[model samples]
Target: MSFLFFTAVGLLAATLGSLVGLGGGIIIVPALIYLGPYFIGKEVSVATAVGTSLAVLIFTAFSSTWSFHKQRKVDFRSGWLYFLTCGPGAMLGSFLTQFVDATTFQLAFGIFMLIMALLLIFKGYLKPVNVRWAIQRTYTDDHGAVHTYGYGALPALAIGLVVGIISGLFGVGGGSLFVPAMMLLFRYPPHVATATSMFVIFLSSIMGTVTHVALGEVDVWMVLGLAPSALVGGWIGARIASSLSSGKLLWVLRITFFLVAVRMIWEGLG
Candidate 1:
């Protein structure tokens, strides 16, 4: 009976996380730690909870990436860069988990989310509808080579490190931060940013999972049970995102980010 309940939660988390690019940890961690144990007694450990969450995320990331690939939106070049930075960062963050309590990490994450939410809300209100992302013609660089570019690598690297560290601490995929950073800092299209972010998440999550395994934190069965549903959810989200306008997607991102922020604050306070 308890397993059935967990399966249901896994399905829902996959669905929501896929659409939002969150890898379901934002929902999974708290739900498992608080609600799951509450209903099932003290059977599960914190390590199991975190491990299961990552397992589900693995599916979500894989599914989402495939979907994006079909749309030809996955930019391997930029994604590789994100992978290089985010993967190491996640490992570093996960190792530090031993020093700080999850509650403190959650609170700090919550504050970060709140600040992002405010900026999004204000930006939405302040920006004119006429303002849209414009695609400029490719430019030539030194050596007379023509390239289509948006922003520099230094900025992307800096942002990736920040997001990667946050993911390690919170057990999130870090897409929430990655997407916006790509869009705002690099001025990439929304879909492009999202696709790239998912790819980066794939590498970072894999690294984080490795760390969790070394620490004896993973629950293999739980991950297997949750993976299928997460895949389905990712496919659906990718399709929906492909069809929607960039503005609508931004709105969705904003609301979800705000919720994430509130949750973080609550976790920190606890």
Candidate 2:
């Protein structure tokens, strides 16, 4: 029954996460922290919840990345660039977790989520000045549609570094930040950003998961219970997202972030 319950939650989390390019950590981490107690009749520590969530993300991120790759929506060039910095950042973040207690981690996650929510809500009015750098390139999607975009390499590298660290620290896939940065800062289309984010997340999650496992933070049984469902859910969600308009996708992301923020804040306060 416990396995079934967590599997169901994983399914839902993966579906929503893939649709919005979040990689499902935001949903899975909180669900496990707040709801696991009810199912297990004991409190689950924040580190355990995060570690388990990262483990599950390994499967979901791969599933989502494969789905997007099939549609040729993923921008390999941009994704690789982000992955380079994200990998190191994730490693550092995982190590840093040794210093963070449950209360501190919970509060930090809540505050970070709240800040991200506000950023998403006011993204339109907070646009940075457009600047072109030497990394200009044109990408063609599976549909033969071409997108030309450019961004400062240094700025992108910095963003990737920060995002990777955050992902490792929070056991998230970092899509929430990566997608927005790609769209707002790099001028990538929403669909392209979402696809590329999944790839970047897949890379970051690999390193983060390994680090968490070494730290003995992951719940192996829970990961086994949730992995299969998360894979299926991610595939289904990516397909659905591919059919939706960019505007609709952004709305879904915005709402999810806001709701997650509220929940995290409430839990942190409690």
Please report, in order, the local distance difference test score of every candidate based on alpha carbons. 0.69, 0.83
How far in Å is the alpha carbon of 29 misplaced in model 1?
1.7
Which candidate achieves the best lDDT against the true structure?
A: 2
User: Under the 3 Å rule for N, CA and C atoms, how many clashes does model 2 have?
Assistant: 0
TM-score of each: 0.80, 0.91
The CA lDDT at 149 in model 2 is: 77
User: lDDT tens string, model 2, 39-154?
Assistant: 75667777788888888988998999999999878889878988889988987887788789877787789888777777767876766447676788777765788877777778
**Can you write out model 1's per-residue Cα lDDT over 125-221, one digit (the tens) per residue?**
4422232233232433324556343655666678878888878766778876776566555656556777777778877888888887788777777
Error of 2 at 39 (Å): 1.8
Task: List where candidate 1 sits over 4 angstroms from the true fold.
Answer: 43-48, 119-149, 245-267
TM-score of 2: 0.91
